[model samples]
Target: MTATIHSLPRKAEPSLEPLMTLVADGLNSVNTVILDRMQSRIPLIPALAGHLIAGGGKRLRPMLTLASAALLEYGGNRHHKLAATVEFIHTATLLHDDVVDGSDMRRGKKAANIIFGNPATVLVGDFLFTRAFELMVEDGSLKVLRILSNASSVISEGEVDQLTAQRQIETSEERYLSIINAKTAALFAAACRIAAVVAERPEADEMALDAYGRNLGIAFQLADDAIDYDSDAAEMGKDRGDDFREGKMTLPVILAYARGDAEERKFWEAAIIGHRTSDADLDHAIALIGRHDAVEATRERARHYAARAVDAIAHFPKSDAKAAMIEAAQFAVARRY
Candidate 1:
């Protein structure tokens, strides 16, 4: 069925001034460390690696890593390395994702696939993946490696599953959520849990952190999907309606299709499943979907995850870091182009 939020005008930017300040500082350290290490690699690797490393993003994963650690009162500066490693792993995945999806743009610039071609993007992504492994080894923590390795495996497998399920009208929520866990939630869970694993926190604490990351990731992805309904190319940095244009069956379309009238359903079936959608057709589809509550339902789901994320960090013992991590969940739900 349709949901509600997108029918309204944009809300005020979520109050993240305090969290932004902390998240920004953490991001700065993460960017420096990640860029420096990426450049240290062999030339071809560095050029490709640096290309994405220098690209602008919210840098949420590294922020999650460092914030979780600080909440646990980690004393060593080694969290910086893990934070950079997190970014490397994230950037590498994006490289592969663009190539696999044949995307032309990301973050307001040509995707590596568009600029360097698919082959270079794939190979460079592989290089960065290897580099992340090498750096993880330096940490000398089997626990860290275990977390990251598992996440990487899941991410790869999840991507394959999503590709396999493409244009799949029969996809269920259980199946969709499973894919989300693999493609999106895995790394988020790992990022938060890695900090706890490193800090020697209680088992309960680690589990809670894992929950925080998983829910945060889910919220972020859901919000991302919501934006696709009317995403502004200049602001969101990608073509608006890219997901719909690709026939990806994101939450909005899925919800709308399920609840649509026969004519509405036929419109989607022909334009989407039948592979005949044009830009004008896609815009019409977005407006039709909005006539229902599809986008609002998706936002509500995102807010649910955001709330769960906040609850997950509740037991972390209050600190600026802890508060900011909680606030990040809200930020994920509320961000706009």
Candidate 2:
């Protein structure tokens, strides 16, 4: 089946710059806490942790924590520690993920696992994970501990589910979404909701922020999945087709397989399920994805989620923080990287 390729123009969205500007002071505090907490008696631990943490990404997860706090007009220094904790959790997960995925790149450079070795990388990840919990305990908020700890468990479960579905072309959309929601959205929700909790906001406000972050997380992952097929390795800060190469059942692959003919199905089985893919087969897979409009479909799905994210926070009063949060949701789908 041939799908006519229609060019989809990129949508304009807010740069994270404005959000960074608004939260610059808070973010600085978060960074200071992150560095202080990452220190260890053993040199290799800090060295390896620094390699990934200092390598530089958007720091969006922690930024969400900061923004959510600011939106609630929080005045205490506690949110800084909480934001740092969120980043540590995120970074720790990335370290373990690189080892598990056998990935060679992260944030546009050699992965920590490759540089430090998998054993060292994994141990450092554990160290960071422990440090994150330490910070949570220092905050002395059982509610905060419960939310983040639960997110950590859900994230592990999501990764396991993804592992179980690896190369399984027959994986259903429901199953795929369940994995994304648990693996990706859960933390986003936790990060955002914790801000409201720290501020002692009403349950409704906490739920609204949670909804905003969860939907935005789903949109972010969907866009990332589409980008794997549409972009080059450098652009993505990792190898292109990493998902396909890893035999992960991302949305593009799922959508294409669902819409493909019997012959195409056989190709998916060999290239994905049977793990017999060659570089040439990867090229063909890209073609098949385009032919089925899988990337476009995935982008539209992301847009839908982004919209829902905006709606989730509709009741909040208009302010720079609120506007930035809404735009962050839009940027989830708008960003190419």
Candidate 3:
């Protein structure tokens, strides 16, 4: 069934800009670490990494690490290093994802793979992955290392899972959740959980923050999937309907397929499953999704996850940082791009 924003429950959201501003100093430190580590004698390594890293991406994952640390009143430099590590992991994933997805644009600019050869992009991604581990080892905490390392493994597994599920019309919601959890949410969970670890906070607090990040990550991905069909390339960093073109079985596609009539199901099977879609077919797909309110339904689902993310932080003492974290959860679902 179709749903509207007014017809479904939603959580209050504040803009992410304020959250970034609140942690501006910490984010600056993270950026410095990112710049320093991207350097290499090979020249191309730093150039390729910097192209995307300096690209106007939001840096949300590292900000989570910084904000979580601040929320706990942790006053140490380790979180800065760890935040940079989280960003490296995220940036590495983006590099690999562009190659895997064969995307031509990133952050409204030509993709690194489009400029530098795919081999270089892939190798630079490897370089950043190794750099992340170096930072982790430098932190000298087995617990932190274990958490990020496992998250990295899960992220790779998630990518493999997504590869397996491509153009799969019958991909179930449960399977989709597993893929997103591993590819996207796992790092977020690790980033926030390690914040509590660095602060020497109790286990309960760490788990709570982990839950928050995981749910927020899920919400963020859901919104991104929905936006792919609705937003302009300039706003979304890629062409509209890229998911449909790629035959990706995102939540909106899955929902529209499941809710379609027999003839409509055939259309989806042809376009998404059979890979016979064209630009006109994408337009029809968008119309079908709108008729079924699939995009709105996905956004509503994102709201549910965002609410859970906000609720997970209830135990933390009220502070500006804590409030900003809560708002960040809301922002995940509410953001247009």
Candidate that would win on lDDT? 3
Of the pair 1 and 3, which is ahead by TM-score? 3
Poorest stretch of ten by lDDT in candidate 2: 1-10
List, residue by residue over 76-101, the lDDT tens digit for candidate 1.
76777887888778898999988877
Q: Spell out the clash pairs found in candidate 2.
A: none
TM-score of each: 0.92, 0.95, 0.96
Per-residue lDDT of candidate 2, residues 38-83 (tens digit):
9999999999999999998788999999999988888887889999
Off by over 4 Å in 1: 1-12, 15-17, 23-26, 40-42
- By lDDT, the better pick of 1 and 3 is 3
lDDT of each: 0.80, 0.89, 0.89
| RMSD of candidates 1 onward, in order | 3.7, 4.1, 3.0
Rank candidates by TM-score, best first: 3, 2, 1
